[model samples]
Target: MSSFDYNSSMIKAAFFDLDETLINAEHAHKAATEKAFAVFGYDYSEERKKSPNHISMGKRVYDNLKARRDGAGISEEQMPMDKLLDIREGYFLSFMKDEIVLLEGAREILEVMKRKHIITAIVSSGTKKYVELVMDIFKLRNDIHFIITGDDVERGKPDPECYLKAYDQALNELKDLHNQECIVFEDTESGITAGKKAGMRVVYIPTSTSVPPINYLPDYTIGSLLSFKTEVLI
Candidate 1:
């Protein structure tokens, strides 16, 4: 991890990534992706989603799919990209409805943030529909004030556009919330870089499949979100 110390008092707002950071979406995504593949009439494997090459390919699922499809010459006429995604999201939502895998200490951490009166936001690469479903599934509609989804920005993670946009919004709504005063809780390398590039401190939580390389780590790293003790930041 980076050898940087943040003044706990400097933090005014915290932005969080949605998927692997807050909840375990791997299992749910597996079921949904498989069903989604059938709609595209392609033989699917869980490996397609977990492979390092694919995982690092795009910051958004649709972008990832488009890259893979375009590379394979799978035209929109054949797959109907937009419709395919709609189906995938539908299946994903349906699968998520039956069983939810909340990450360790997610609820407690969220409650703590709320109690501290720290402004919170969801800065995710997921679509609005997907983010909304997860918020509903976790009963977290009111936990965060702003939600910046994939659709909200033209560029994706590692681009800093999303987090920068978030920073601009935070400034409007929060007192004394400058760039350095903001914190980002993220899981992916792209997300970590994006937060840093946006000039905010980051607390990196690594999922089993998305651990970042040590040389380019965030300000802080923890094995699990539960391990992120709030006292340090308080």
Candidate 2:
């Protein structure tokens, strides 16, 4: 929930982080990775996902996973990168198709944002295909303004490339938009850091699975988007 002053601000655009911010991406990613590995008779491990923590992802899921797994010294279980990607993405979409669930108050807040006409977009380190699939599953294909996936950026979160690109896109979509007039909602430290580096205020809403590292703070932190009124910007 949010409570603040109003009537003296300019917040024209709002950017969101997809995974763990709006939807249950952690669960879906885990499910997909598990299925992808099982398809090749390998097991998914937490160590398999640790190598790319600080880097932004700009590759397809297979390449992304391959690199990380190789870096982790577990590349022996790999299959063709393209095939791995197809399998991962297929299972991911299929797994999430029936189980995709929005965070508390997610739709309500989006509806409010829509009614007010504030330009909204998704700035995520996730792949374009996967993000689109998740949006489709959640029935949010047209609910937001746009989505800037890792595929759209040369660099990813913590590098500011994705969020900065998102900011530029939002500006293009909304004339007279300023950096300060944009706010980012994120659930991870890297995402919050990226938003700040992009010169936009950030709201941190931590998810159960991806907790923010200690001391990683944002302009604001709310339990849910429900009480976050647009007027609070003023």
Candidate 3:
């Protein structure tokens, strides 16, 4: 029931993380990984169910493929980085088509933010294409003010680059607003860390399962986006 007054002219923008925060796409990631594994004739269902710390699933898959190629004595000339990227992109697209789903209150929360005229943007560790797919699925492309994806930054979440990029984008979009006026909504530990590191007030929304322990507690924590209210906007 905690609330904050947002009527003050100071607060202006709200930054959000996509996966697990604004959109429930972890399931999609797993499905994508499984499909990607299938392309290599490897089944990952057993590992997928038991593992909760596979944040860099795409990179992991790429590394696995690289290791296999090396073991087979494939020349470096044969396995170019572009080819690897293409394979990952193909698998991710397949996963998006088959398994992406938005979290239950995402549309409502976003609508409320828009009604309030709060500048909103998505800052996610996911690739640009994957994030866009989810946004399209949720019909949230136009609703969001901006987006900062993995491809936009040199470092991903937990490093502050993504949030910084989003903050910069928001500042450009909401030119009248100051940096301190922005806030962030996140679910994963890395996402929260990134937001906090960027000096924005953060609200944590834990997922139903696989809630990672946050090293730095967020300004606030909620069980779901459904619990977010205007009172907490400050």
Per TM-score, the best of the predicted structures is: 1
* Least accurate 10 contiguous residues by lDDT in model 3: 52-61
Give me the overall lDDT of model 1.
0.77
Q: Please provide TM-scores, in order, for all candidate models, with all chains considered together.
A: 0.87, 0.82, 0.78
Per-candidate local distance difference test: 0.77, 0.72, 0.68
lDDT by residue for model 3 (37-123), tens: 455555556444333443542232344344444544444675564565576678667767566667777888888888888888887
Put down candidate 1 lDDT per residue, 1-234, tens digits, no spaces: 443364555577889998888877777776776787787787556435333453442277677666555555567898777887788888888888765677898888888888988788889988888788888878897788889999999989878999998888887887567787788988888888889989888888876667554534587887777777576454
Ranking by TM-score: 1, 2, 3
Candidate 2 lDDT by residue in tens digits, 1-234: 333435536677889887667877566667887888778776777656656553323233544576666665665545666677778888777777666678887887777778878888877777887788777777886678899987887765677888788777887777778888888988777778788888888888866645454544687778776757667442
Winner on TM-score between 1 and 3 is 1
lDDT, residue 234, model 3: 35
The top-ranked prediction according to lDDT is: 1
Candidate 1 residues lying further than 4 Å off, grouped into runs, are 1-9, 46-51, 54-58, 71-73, 214-216, 232-234
